[model samples]
Target: MNNKVITKEAAAELIRDNSTICTVGMTLVSASESILSSIEKRFLDTDSPRNLTLVHAAGQSDRNRGIQHLAHPGLVKRIIGSHWGLAPKWMEMISGNQVEAYCLPQGQMVHLYSAMAAGLPGRLSPVGLNTFIDPRIEGGKMNSCTKENIVEVVKFKDKEYIFYPSIPLDTLIIRGTSADPKGNLTTDEEAMKLEVLPAVLAAKRFGARVIAQVKYLVEGGSLDPKSVVVPGDFIDNIVICDNPERDHRQTSSWYYDPAYCGKIRVSPQQETSKAPLDIRKIIGRRAVDFIKPGAIINLGTGIPNDVIGQIVKEKEMESDVTITVESGIYGGLQSGGIDFGIGRNLSAMISHQDQMLYYNGAGVDITYMGAGELDRNGNVNATRLGSQCTGAGGFIDITQNARHVVFCSTFTTKGLEIELNDGKLNIVKEGHIKKLVNTVNQISYSGKLAVEKSQKMHFVTERAVFEMTDKGIMLIEIAPGIDLEKDILQLMEFKPLISEKLKTMPMNIFTA
Candidate 1:
């Protein structure tokens, strides 16, 4: 076996100028930090590897690490990924017109890697039809600098589908838990084994150099056959890192927790027991009412993340329902902040590809997602609105499949204020922006399609609750102390069908 061990600096030097590189992870979990950090260091020090394209199926890291480390203006020429919400520096580069960005559906990007690994020309699907990813629209272009059309909308038997042509990958950088002397990789202690196999094989199939970073070293054949995920034959080089416990997990705040890696079983733990107080907490309590034991639930990022955590802490139903983040953590203490999309005492960790397949195939029972703006027809904008290009990460894949959906949001945003007095809500001041609009600026969730499929749809807010009815959204519940005509009808852009059995939301959700 050729000597595979290498220094981080040497690994960084392997990347050539103007080569396309592919990465892994979403919102911090399973991201390649050591290599990305080294690459960033190399570029900043010597300005080599300029004009390189970065490819990822999902957002690799937050502002501090992962792909965010390589956000320099000239180092990256283009980026093809599903989400950029976590990479603020890269977003800034796109905002400054110094980098080209293209955002596609997370599922499509993952499948495209599989296609590449299989030596296929490109991946074909109807996932991006009628959405911004279609060529007729922005064509997956996120910034002004991206000139090439990455997606094409083609017709098949009177049906329209999108085709994502695979690009030649020059290098692949991935991080795993261990490697034998021959470079067989294992994810024994990682938070997630996210697309390691696909990314490695995809790069190798295309004659690209594959570099891996590992936490520990092992002698040849010391690693269990089943434990070794990526074969040593394909890995070109390996970099063993010491003290991976320092910066390897999702965030610096957390060391490795056995629960997150599925090494331990999960039991009900009291996260919180207080009644919902904040507006998001109120919405979460309402969403909890929809929860049924043993049902699989996927929580969207940002605010919906809070809703689920508040419910788990307040109700201590950690074991009642199976909770999954889009990044593939399940049954642990779902947290927020920089540690979003991770489970503290998780039941299992999986790859983003498997989760996407489950989502696209309707394996999820229901999804609780955050919405920025919603139209009267129940169309929710989870991604971009107007010039703000908050790329739809897994939003399209999760919503397009799971027929039963509950969208959570405040009745208003920006400067909305309310008073909760004796379990009664009083609107002190309305937000400058109304979340319920006449028409959504973007179609992240199709209420019309949901209605056509007879999917159950519910919208939960601190002030009001609505359900999809044949005649459009029907107001079903309102918070106590809120006037039906003034607070509910006057606030919305259009009138909804008032439910014949209109009732007030539960007081238990408000008072401690």
Candidate 2:
């Protein structure tokens, strides 16, 4: 067997200038940072490989790890990815019109990679219809600098679908925990194996170089066959990262945790709220009212995580619903913050693509996600907030397909304060910024589309509950002790269709 072992510098040399590189990562869980950073380092030193196009399914970091190293203005000409919350520096550049960024649904991206593996024209699906990704709504362009139409909406069988043009991809940057002498890779120690196989197959099928970064390199045939994910035939070079602790670990604050890898299940501990009850807990408390039993549910990071945490802490919906993140973990303990992609004691784990396929097929019964801004027409802007882009991770995929959808957010933001006074809610001080806007910065999810599909949608805020009607959003429920005209309607930029059967929110939700 030929030894595929090579230094990172030697591997980086293989990538030429103006190359298109596709990476696999779900928010830094299992990523090839050593290889990518090596390429970025080489580019900075030699100024070669400048103007490269980078593709990724999930946004991969918090400005310090993953693609942030490649965030240099000239290093990359364009970026195509699902989410950008983790990559803040690149987002700043995008907001400043320094680089071209294309945001796609995570499910469509995974399937597009599959299409690339099969040598197809491109992915054609309705996953992005009527949303910002729709050609009619900026065509997935993140900035004014990106003018080329990478995505187009076309009619297929009398139904409109978004078609992403296939770009000839050449270089693949991927990571695994171990690789044999022949380069068969195994990700035994990684958290979630996201976008690895499709990327490798696509790279090999297109006659591009595949560089495998691993923490351990062993002799040929030493790795178990079942453990090997990427075959040696598909891999061209192997780079061994000696210090995984420094080089490959997910984050800087902590190393590997057993709960993340499913090594052991940690029971969620019920803790009392010593701190003041904030907007998140209140929204979480109200959102749980929508969760139905025996449903396949998905929750986004941040507020959604808090909602699930509150559910578990209160011993509610413990067995009624199967919770999943876009990372493919099904019905396990939902993680929080940076470790948002994995689960503990996973009842099942599917490839992120497979999970997405299920979601795009309308397999999800319900979903609870967060939003940054909302318009009178019920459109949502969850990704961008006045140039701060938190790319739509699975926002389009989940909201577009789920049978029932709930968007959680405070009625307003920026210095928002609330007081819980003996089973009644009080807005101690109103927030200066109203999230109920005249028009969202970007339409991540289309309310018009949701109504067309006959989907049940609800907007849950700290003090109000809203529903989507045929015409527009209707105020259906207001929290107790909150005035209608003075508090709710006065705060919103536009008056909504008020429900004649308007009711007060359950006071038990606020009594704590």
User: What's the lDDT of the predicted structure labeled candidate 2?
Assistant: 0.82
Candidate 1 lDDT, tens digit per residue, 371-446? 8877878788877655566678888888777857889998888898988999899999888887888987677777
How big is the positional error of residue 292 in model 1, measured in Å on the Cα after superposition?
3.8
lDDT of each: 0.80, 0.82
Q: Write the per-residue lDDT of candidate 2 for residues 1-512, one digit (tens) a residue.
A: 48988888888888877889888877677766777788889988988778989888888875578888788888899999888887888889899898899898888888888898888988889888888898887888889989988888888789888998666778888888889888899988777867789878877778888888888888888988998888998888889986788778854344577666667776545332332356787788888778767877888887987556546546556678788888888776666676677766778777788888888895588888899888999898998888787788888988899998899999998888888888788888889888998999999989998888899999999899999989899999999989999889999999999999999999887876
Best by TM-score: 2
- The parts of candidate 2 lying over 4 Å away from their true place are 250-253, 267-276
Q: Which pairs of residues clash in candidate 1, taking residues 3 or more apart in a chain or in different chains?
A: 259-346, 272-313, 272-314, 332-345
Extract clashing residue pairs from model 2.
Answer: 61-86
For candidate 1, the per-residue lDDT at 508 reads 77
Candidate 1 accuracy as TM-score: 0.92
- Worst ten in a row by lDDT for model 2: 268-277
Model 1 whole-model lDDT (C-alpha atoms):
0.80
